[model samples]
Target chain A: MKARVHVMLKDGVLDPQGEAVRHALGTLGFDGVEGVRQGKVIELDLATEDAAAAEAEVREMCEKLLANTVIEKYDIEIG
Target chain B: MKARVHVMLKDGVLDPQGEAVRHALGTLGFDGVEGVRQGKVIELDLATEDAAAAEAEVREMCEKLLANTVIEKYDIEIG
Candidate 1:
């Protein structure tokens, strides 16, 4: 199974990386560009047969290493 | 309105950041976790009323700034 995890900064959290990108875009002449918040993406190729178990494992992966739960939340998609 | 942009590395591309996180998670006792691909998250508290135009702007943002289009792709959601 394959899964994609998108972990993003929560509302009201500061994102300096995204801000930098937004500014860079403005410099690059992308006039419509506004704001950007940068986060992490995790793609997993698992050998497990259980999607439920994989979700749990991935959640633990986020909590422990992939995300700073203090300021970010994650969404998971499995295929 | 707010929009969320998730940019992820395409399959076959190297994601050293995610691999590092996955290794760290394993070290931290997340045993079942397998692979990880790190990406960028952009959160926009857009002031625009047009979701379609905003989506276009964000797509440009991703192409020009938030993601390295050479190896990454993005998805945008507006609310």
Candidate 2:
């Protein structure tokens, strides 16, 4: 199975990196981009074939290590 | 309009960050995670309602600054 995990900073949390990217974009002449929030995508190749199990396992991975639950949230897409 | 850009390193590129994350996962006892590739997600809030325009603009942003065309590929999702 394959899983893609999208990890994003939680709302209200400060994202210095994201802000930096936004600033860089403005400097590069890309206008009308009101806001930019940068997150992460983690692609995982698992050894299982069961979609349900893969999702559940990946969720555990997210909660345990893939994400910082205090400031980040993660969504898992299994295929 | 809103847009989400997924940027990933091209295959065969060295991913030290991804390797670090994978190592950390092993330390945390999450076995069976054979591989992990890390990328970035840029979420933009655009000032236009035209989906086509948003997509085009976002792609320009990606090519200009959001992603490094030499080693990174980006996918855009507009809504």
Q: lDDT values of the candidates? A: 0.76, 0.89
Candidate 1 displacement at residue A37 in angstroms: 2.3
In the range B1-79, model 2's lDDT, one tens digit per residue, is 8899999999999888888888988888777778889999989888889998888888888888889999999999998
> What is candidate 1's lDDT per residue for A1-79, written digit by digit as tens?
7878888789798888878877777788765545666776677877687889878877776787677899988888877
- Model 2 scores what on Cα lDDT? 0.89
Q: For model 2, what is the alpha-carbon lDDT of residue B19? A: 89
DockQ of each: 0.55, 0.86
TM-score of chain B of each: 0.89, 0.96
Best by lDDT: 2
Q: Show where candidate 1 strays beyond 4 Å.
A: A26-35, B29-31
